[model samples]
Target: MSSTALRRSLLAASAVLVTAGVWLAAGTASAGTLTGTLYRDTDTPVARWLAANPGDSRAAQISSRIASQPATRWLSNFNVGTIESEVAGYVGAATRAGQVPALTVYGIPNRDCGGASAGGAPDLATYQTWVNGIARGLAGRTTLIMLEPDSIALQTCLSAGEITARDQALATATRTLKAAGAKVYLDGGHSAWNAAAEQARRLANAGVADGDGFYTNASNFQSTANESAFGRSVLSALSGRGINGKRQVIDTSRNGGAAGDWCGDDNTDRRIGRYPTLDTGDANIDAYLWIKPPGEADGCAYPAGSFQPSLAASLATGAANPPTTTPPATPPTTPPTTPPTTPPTTPPTNPPTGACGATYATSSSWQGGFQGQITVKAGTGAVNGWAVSWTLASGQSINQVWGGVLSVSGSTVTVRNAAWNGSLQPGATAEFGFIANGPAGTSSLSCSA
Candidate 1:
């Protein structure tokens, strides 16, 4: 070959090496990547409806209800046409800004398997159509996709006949999406929700062998330390079925802290946590994903089926986004008296308060029960009856209460000390508290009245 040709070949090889190096460096960094569903700012299905009718009250109400539920909205939002555009914009901005924002693709039918958290495609036909659109949205993009969360592994709650149908639907969805050139990860629930063998069997039954690998901890809180072990076991089980991957990825969404309960309404507390990291114990185990978006209510801080602005603010802080640091130290115990702050009694005429206070405490505890005490001091006038109301974020409900009368209204939790027990003497203070389960890091005291 001529000298010029030899030089050109060497240059080409050097370029390839440079690209590989960048990819490798990105993989090893301590900063965890972000990954979750891409959705439009609005919360409605007509937003994607084919008919495109101008207005329909029934559809409007359904959309409003579904939009209120973050999980449902997270999954269904992909159906909207604008979602792809939003993601495209984010990718461009991140690329220009020199960052890689990991992303996930949810919105499968039968998500969460008919539980209180369940909402998905209307049917298999609708799901297939939606999948195609999502693939189009992702075409030429570099965002990671956590496909069809909880659709395959959590099917145990279905009947035998229903399971068969769901399996076919999931397999079809996975194959169709993969064909669209989207890398997909079927949710395997979490280490705590299902055993390795069981999850593997279900995935196999759902035809996960056709996809890249399965995902775990999408929205669940199985610890990374525990999820890695569980992931390997599932991978080993798949080994017998001839799946080629060495390992799978797990979600680190709310796993920075301990695990939360499966079901408890008043469990509306939020906790600050680190972002998703790539420190998987095994090589085959891919990067950890924030499949559950920060600021999206987990039914605890938000309404049972809605998003809470206060909760979303708490999630935006670095403490929960790409969790690298530990959350603020929770008060060891409820202080005997309110910290001496003679601030005005009127509510702050503001939105997006800091990550400390009653809302933050209750929203923080949505994942774990709150352990604290509140003393209600009487104002200048003689105090009449007292009510200690604890309103949960969207989707959260009252798990348990002590020392007061507790009432639940959708996502609002109220604890009232009745008239018989209501009087507070002038210059005297009334004290009460309740051990309540909520989301991770919820605001504790809304009203000390």
Candidate 2:
């Protein structure tokens, strides 16, 4: 190949690698490569949803899509008496599985600015005592601790004195967790909410110098690319302040789709993001973790942290866009806001070959779910009706299907043409999209009428 062709090919390959989290610059060592498998909690919210709603339309989708992925286990309440044992049991399970447990320590006093996720320890002293129990449970094994979700970032309600007190408490909590052999990531707000410089300074106040690093997008829905880039900027800022070598993680729990309201059930555009893993190609990014379990309310729709299967199903529709890193060229601004119930007006680029033909593609991918579209085309002859079938992977299921009728019997899923779409001229095509539960599955499609 010519040198130019080689360079272009190399660049294309590089872009693909970068999107999978292998973003490279100069001498930055990737964070997740050295770690063990990130832990998967058996009792995650989606797990419970599967148990209770097996007969529900979205149960299978939620089971294979969201519930199968590992999410951070947040210790939000301050029941000191059981905190240690509770943590110990979780850690033990992770140890048995030989996976690295990811824990979120959220009992900070006045968490969430007293908003939907309000309530923490009564005071800093109680918070410390509570953290100590969490530490004891760790017992010197390696774990990832997201010290607090918004303890520093969402501090508008606090006075200067109050912010200072919270800062000190976080510093103490970091030390306690680290001493117990945990890799503690102090909160670094998120890219959308705080400027890199400001959050770096805030993290400094919260003792980023002593922690493993800082984490971003915990319970917030910012794209992983945006959050990971923000983390690099924060690290650079931290280095300027004489604190260096800090790695970061992003909560890719529910940031799929567009950047809109980060709370409640009203937003249909929200989707789950990348699954948890430390293998981010970017050395500065430790992992893209699902810190906030999908389907749980952010205080707007249901009580804070209430898991809803229907909500999970909606978010899972991004194929539950599997929280991939780089999104394809900018998504059309208006497309996500509108439901995809209407078939696309455009014709298929692929001409019809047989009486029926079908194709599937992932429209956009994010943490928990992905959006997929299937195009049905008439081959050499006009077709009055058609059906397409494929076997879903173990965890693959459908949430909302449009432009077609959907049914699942065991792993095999079949979609038949909708009323308007069933009638197609030869070589004409009709398309449909749906929110799927898991990653885009193998495309061994069979079409018939």
Considering every candidate listed, which one attains the maximal TM-score?
2
**Model 1, residue 173: displacement in angstroms?**
2.6
Q: How far does residue 353 in candidate 2 sit from its true spot (Å)? A: 66
True lDDT of residue 224, candidate 2: 82
Candidate models: Cα lDDT each: 0.46, 0.68
Provide the clashing-pair count of each candidate structure.
81, 30
TM-score of 1: 0.53
lDDT of 1 by residue, 1-449 (tens): 00000000112221211121122232232322222222222212222221243254333332332222222114333234344554555444433333333445554545555343434444556557666666565454443456666676666667899888878877876676566444556677787787788888888888777776777776566677787788778989989877755347666545554467742223334333334444433565656555554334443322223333333333332342222232221222332121111111222233223211232222112123333344455554556666555556654444433334668776666666533335655444443333444443344566454
Candidate 1 weakest ten by summed lDDT: 1-10
Local accuracy of candidate 2 as per-residue lDDT tens digits, 1-449 = 00000000112321311112112322323344334355676655455446555688877667667777777777764456667887887877776554567787776766676555555565677678889989999887667788888887888989999999989988988888878777788888888888999999999998878887888887567788898888889999999999987888888777877776567366888887777666677767777777777777665544456576678888888564344432212223232322221223345667656678888776544344555767787887888999999988877777656557789898888988766557778887766655566775546888896
Name the lDDT of candidate 2.
0.68
Decoy 2 TM-score against native? 0.65
